[model samples]
Target: MTRPDPADLHPWIAGYLTPYTGRTRQNATQYLRRWETWCGQRGTSIEDATRTDIEAWRAHLSARGVRARGIGAALSPVRGLYLWAAQSYLITHDPAHLVRMPRRPTRSQRPWLDRHQLRRLLDYVDHAGDPAMRAAVHLWSLCGLRPAEPRQLLISDLGTYEGRMSIGLSYRKAGGADRLTVSPPVEAAIRAAVAGRGRGPVLYNENTGTALSKAIARLRLIRILDAARVPHVTPYGLRAGFITLSLEAGVPERDVMYAAGHSSSAQTAYYDRMRHTIRARAVHELTDWLDLTGTPGVTPMSDVPATLPP
Candidate 1:
């Protein structure tokens, strides 16, 4: 019996996955390419794959310093390709299904900047060399806008209605257009930053006058953080701080969800947990109650007088 050529499979897979070309296809292609390389080194074809072969491959990946999540992601395309081949009657069974993915550890709650740190960071941005960078940081800190969303913003997006400045966010991931009423301070910052620049991307490279990339934004943020000597702060951390501060200020969760462009209320819940304001407020109230009861010197519950006669 002759073996099928793996080179012939690329066009078929690409054609089948034409609808998923952007990031998803790119990731899948990377995983598939790695699998092909592995299989070539072993002198095996997809049709000749077996469960034992998959287990050995998993071990090989683990030995190569692949983390559990990376291992899972690497195997995902293999599973999909096997299923596709099975569905097309090119293979008798899907060997990829026999490969068990390692369990990934649960991630801890995300971190957000506290109110004091947030204020300091914004002040630092204000004093930064680039005015556009200052405005961009201000928007992210104040409005909880995603990094990429602000990059695509235009001057026309900022509109004034009933003496209130509002910004329209059209390309949101939440599948609808939403508008945020810019705070007076933020609007002033943006106007001052873009004073001479005509309608285009609001956030642009200081040197090139072109729209900023995520890498450039990240590098600029690192420079700002290093110069200010602020530790553990990222651009996303500023956005998280905006959400946390809003929740602490008694803003309703649904309203925060809208402003943050969160796809679900669960994401808002995560932000609430990170805020820690509710816990702090509860402790404050408890301390106040203890103080009002004339228990300042009390050590523990055992020190309290029992209401029942002893």
Candidate 2:
């Protein structure tokens, strides 16, 4: 049987999701559809779903072995739709307004690589055969670009303002042009990666000559970590580490938030922890580490095969 158009059942859905991307639109539609089906089974319409009805749906998801995170993801669209409808005067109240989703685990609760592990990973990437892969690591670790952000980056995105180098993100997480001040290493890596090309992706597959997909980029990072003997971490975890390190180094909270593409300082603060000792102590203090380049167990770039493997 054909599924009825969600917008047909509720015309507001179309306009509500119109601003979102195709993938997001599809996911939101699916989530709303699930809610619609559940409402019908419960002898109610989405417009009439009470707070109790939403709670029951949550309970239903829990009974089906859906974890808290999964349940929250599925319910997000439902809440969004109701909230939008209420604001638009299509509904008298938002049943999902007071209803709460399960709390996500705190940043400190999740596993992330430490400074030593990150240095090791970078060293491994530097010695890897792919220049694009090495550049990707630098962008993530140094500039804190999201996995997809660097993939969409073009040569034109490289910029300088007030004599400081920066990378302009066209597809920022917040849906606007976000320019991040690049560190020396980040600037060098990006400049070298796009040296010959006037325009195109900063990282691309040599064989395909196309931008690397998120999955492929993630696989490359995993391989680098394995080679470096670092514990497995998600791409997001690398971003978390960047925020954590920057804050620990006494970088202003606003600067860290902007660099990490976080919408709020609170989002950046989640990664801050008292137990994680500062890596760049000299950055916060006047004293300098005698040899910051010499990470334990990793040789200097001069000793490693820095060039792309033949």
Candidate 3:
């Protein structure tokens, strides 16, 4: 299929994306262009697209082995395009509105570091010669940043919010601007990483002295874990560990959800259920019950709810 000319697409795309950020506008344009290419193959344009056409296009992509999430991403812009066009009176109906994308598959709990593994990883980063790597590790282990989040930080993004050190986050996968509050140690590492650079991205390619690529960040994590003699884990595992450790240490579920940018309590609870500390505490309570009464009938002390403070 021939690609649609940008000259023909630019005017409509510009108006549709006026409210989006630069990055979002770029993504929307890419997604829409892919749709346009599909339409071109079928001898139609998006302006004449129908619900059936959209559904067939979705099926075509699925037949090509596109994952459910990718199908959703591709369709979202087409939906937006029709909505914008309908609102502008360029089209009488929004065909893309009723077109359904595939349901996202449920994700299982991902792997993460335990206390001993995390401690060793942090120790290695702390002693490493590179300031940028130190900041990257601390952001992962302490502040619970997504891998891409740390790499996207700019010098101007650092600030004080409510008397706590905060990092402005603009590149969240879920979208929207947000902030991450950090402890003094993490803040210090961030400052050290940005030292001698007053602007632009904070995380840098150690060799290129430019913003670190996502691929490079993942590879870097593997090397860092190997050097520290810790077992292999994903950068996402660092984030999961942060949430797990925080909940296990009795941080409120709501607070953990907010800090970790989780959209719901259910997601936060999922991490809580996976924390090893909860099992350890339960085992200790059972041991104590057995030692005290030599009875199998006694409930573990951990099963009792704590009294509220007056």
Best by lDDT: 3
Tens-place lDDT per residue, model 3, 1-310, is: 2434456675667678777765556778888878878888999987787898899989988899998878988889888888999999998888987777688744435678888888898888878777777888889878777777888789889889889889999766556789878898898888888887889788877688798877777777788888999888887788888888887778888988888777787777665635465778888899787785546777668865687457
Q: When superposed on Cα atoms, how far off is each prediction in RMSD? A: 6.8, 13.4, 7.9
Across 1-310, the per-residue lDDT of candidate 2 in tens digits comes to 2444654746766767867764456778778878888999999988788999999999999999998778988989988988888988988978899999898765545466678888888777767777787788888777777767777887788889777778787666556677777777677777767768888888867778888888898888778888889988876677777877777677898988877877898777777763245545545454334444445876677878758788
**Which residue runs does candidate 3 get wrong by more than 4 Å?**
1-11, 108-110, 160-164, 170-179, 195-200, 229-231, 262-310
Clashes of each: 0, 0, 0
lDDT value, candidate 2, whole model: 0.77
The TM-score, computed over Cα atoms with residue i paired to residue i, of candidate 3 is 0.72
Alpha-carbon error at 135 in model 2, in Å?
Answer: 1.6
Give the TM-score comparing model 1 with the true structure, all chains together. 0.68
Pairs that collide, model 2: none
Q: 1-310 in candidate 1: lDDT tens per residue?
A: 1322446456545544555534456677777767767777788855677777677788999999998878998888778888887888887888877677788644324466777877777788777776677777888889988777777788878888778888888867666688888887788778877777877777767678787778888888888877766666666777877887898888998989989998887777665644465878788899797675556565677766678566
Quantify all predictions' global Cα lDDT against the true fold. Answer: 0.75, 0.77, 0.80
Candidate 1 local accuracy as lDDT? 0.75
